[model samples]
Target: MPKQTNVRCPNCGIQFAAPVETVIDVSQNPNGKMLLLAGSLNAFQCPNCGSPVRVTTPFLFHDGSKELLMVYVPPELNLPKPEREKAIGDLMRELTAILPQGSFKSYMFQPREALTLQGMVDTILQADGVTPEMMQQQRDRLSVLESLLGAPEETRPSIIEQNDAKIDTQFMQTLSLLIQRMAAEGQTEVAQQLAIVQEDVLAFSSFGQTLMRDAQEQEAVMQEVAESIQALGAQPVRADFLSLAQRYAGDDQRLEALVGLIRPAFDYAFFQDLTAAIGKAPADEREKLETLRDRLLELTQAVDAQTQAVIADAAKLLQVFASAPDEQALDGLIRENVAVLDEAFLSVLLANLQQAESQGKSDLVAKLTDIYERVLGVLREQMPPVLRFVNELLGAPTPEEQQKMLDENAKAFGESLLTTIDAVSEAMSARGEDSIIERLAELRAAAEQALA
Candidate 1:
């Protein structure tokens, strides 16, 4: 977990709070690795100036899947050789305390240190087969993005004109991807800023403007596809959907139209169409057709995964709440996920309660509500700082009062709350309290080993 530390902005000379985590044990919660890759792991937006600043702290990156362990200390810190060795020793000790007995490999004892965070990330990406050329392209996009954001409104056009080639379809897609991630993580302000940038890109850049036009056509095609699919009788199966796909032109235009529109719905039926299209194509063009099919298949899987991950968390929490044999089990689950009392979980509980009520079950509805509140009370007791902080912020008399409180206690409330948020976000991918319990057990077992 990141700690709250003071940061004095070079430009503004005002100090603000930021999160700095030194040890990231990705074995327990791999989602932390994702946040790290997205560049949001330890990023803080200065409330005073809205400028993004990073905490200049060393971090350990661990990925058990690859049997890899590494550390990064900023060269700017310039710790003495003895002190650097001591710090690395301390960090590794902590890492050892969070893994199961004998789970760590022999190579982990000899630590690898990076002089920069980028070097650490690049190392990981290279292992994943992301080419240096791809990494350079990403860096180039970021450079142009920085320039555009820094330029004045009047000068922005010139910056855009100079980097017009860089601001192509790929850039727009990258921006859209980031925006979705921000929204999912509840970073509303950042998502809004990205949206504005997206709008400006779509309006100002020639390629962006053309892509926007194509997107409109895509949406139209999607609407028509939806209408066509719905017009089929109830319980339409794979055959029915494929029959609809056959109505489109057999050439590349049809494939493009199909992909442009109903991309997410490319299930077995769509694959059937793709198979037929591939079979009909000339041998030379068959590879291109197969490539298109492969792309859509990958896209469909991703779309389905994102949806399931978002909603499955809520559903899983509900199941745990309803199935707890007694208060102890409920307490354990709530402590594990922290969303034991969230509304989505409650909605599921309420639906079950209503089902019981409809069947004339006695006191089940009241029983469910009581159990929920009781478990929530336990969470408040266990993590009062977070619970109290969130309560007061929400219970503020007015928006202005809320803002004032946040500004005054930024350090007390902000970094601490963010730690909990990071935990919760990681938990979204968890199976339920069971997975969380197993994870915590692993940590506890490792801690005990350190004590031994």
Candidate 2:
């Protein structure tokens, strides 16, 4: 839990309450660890002048996985020796009191002191296997990004061309993370500027262009394979999948897409059937079938591995939310990690919620439910206004209710609401969602009349 402390803004002199995090436990509060690494922990913008202010106070950093305990006190604080020692002792006592019994180790008593925040960050990164060279490289990339962001809009292309070599996968990833962080902090103008820089980087840099091209090709492959599977009808049997696999035998991307899209269909029984068919195949066809079988085995293994990794990451993130000390902290974590709140994460949350309910863990079930709703709320807030309105209209229970909603919001949405309804109706129709399509059609009529 953060301590709300009165902070006087240097720029405006107006005082405000800021949540100051004095202790970061990596095992429990991973989100705090992330914010600390991002250099935004205890950072706030003044309400009066909107100037960034950072709280400089003594804090304890603990990572149980690494068996690391460290303490940092801002040098600028200039506390007397005894006062500093007492502050450190207080933080240590607070940490030890909350830790599980018998889990305290010797390192907790004699916490290592970091002379500076950078030194503390470096030590943490080093423990995570980030070498000094890697750190320098990251710093270089960050410098280049800063230069790009600082340059004039018209000059960005040339700047990117000059520093194209520094613009690699890690650089782009860092830029993306910065954008997300800025947006989460409500710095919309800065986030928008960073977004423009990202587009220019993707446009001008060599690696960025390659990434763009690969993304396009992958999207095309996904669409083609999705259409193929859709053509397989509602109930595609094992033989149907086998035939589909053989059709795209040598095309690794399409084969990968096929396997990823319908991984469950390629079970042990399906593979056994394939082996049987391969054994009975003619000599000319046997080699091709065998090759396809080998390739599919590799693809399935890769897909399963990737899925497991995603699930593990999702579970870890969910645990962070569950361990949040308060609703405010949980909401902040959700907003900070919003970019990763995808179907896989939601599925994991749902499964956990179901298990808690079944096991009669009412408290856990309630917590998970709150997290789930908050996650969905954040996601909806990110959607376009039209889509959000459509979602609200759909949530109305009956035609009368939907019609009432449409009437209330018609002036605001105008004809755009009718257009969105039509688009959604078409999409739902294609997916064979008859009930939804019917409701959308009626709503579309009502909306059109309302707008008219």
Best by lDDT: 2
TM-score of 1: 0.51
Candidate 2 minimal-lDDT segment of 10 residues: 44-53
Summarize candidate 2's per-residue lDDT along 1-452 as a digit string, tens digits. 67767788887799877667898887767768888898778876665665667788899999988999999999999999999999999999989877888999877779999998989999999999999999999999989888988999999999999998888889999999998777665465788899999999999999999999999899789878878888999888999998899899899999988898788989999999999999999989999999999999999999899999999999999997898777655765676677789989999999999999999999999999999999999888666589899998889878788888878887798878878888888667545577999888877877888888
What tens-digit string does per-residue lDDT give for candidate 1 at 1-452?
A: 44456677655678765445678887664545766777656555445554555566667888877777888877898989998888888889888888899787977978787767788889889877898999999889878776765666677777777878888767877787677555433355766666777777777888888988888786666556656665776576666655565465344444455544455456676687779878988898788667766765655676567556756766655664566555434443343344234555656666777797888877777667766676556445434466565455545777567656656664555455555544543443232244645543443333233333
lDDT of 2 at 17: 70
Question: Native-vs-model 2 lDDT?
Answer: 0.86
Question: Which pairs clash (backbone N, Cα, C closer than 3 Å) in model 2?
Answer: none
Clashes of each: 0, 0
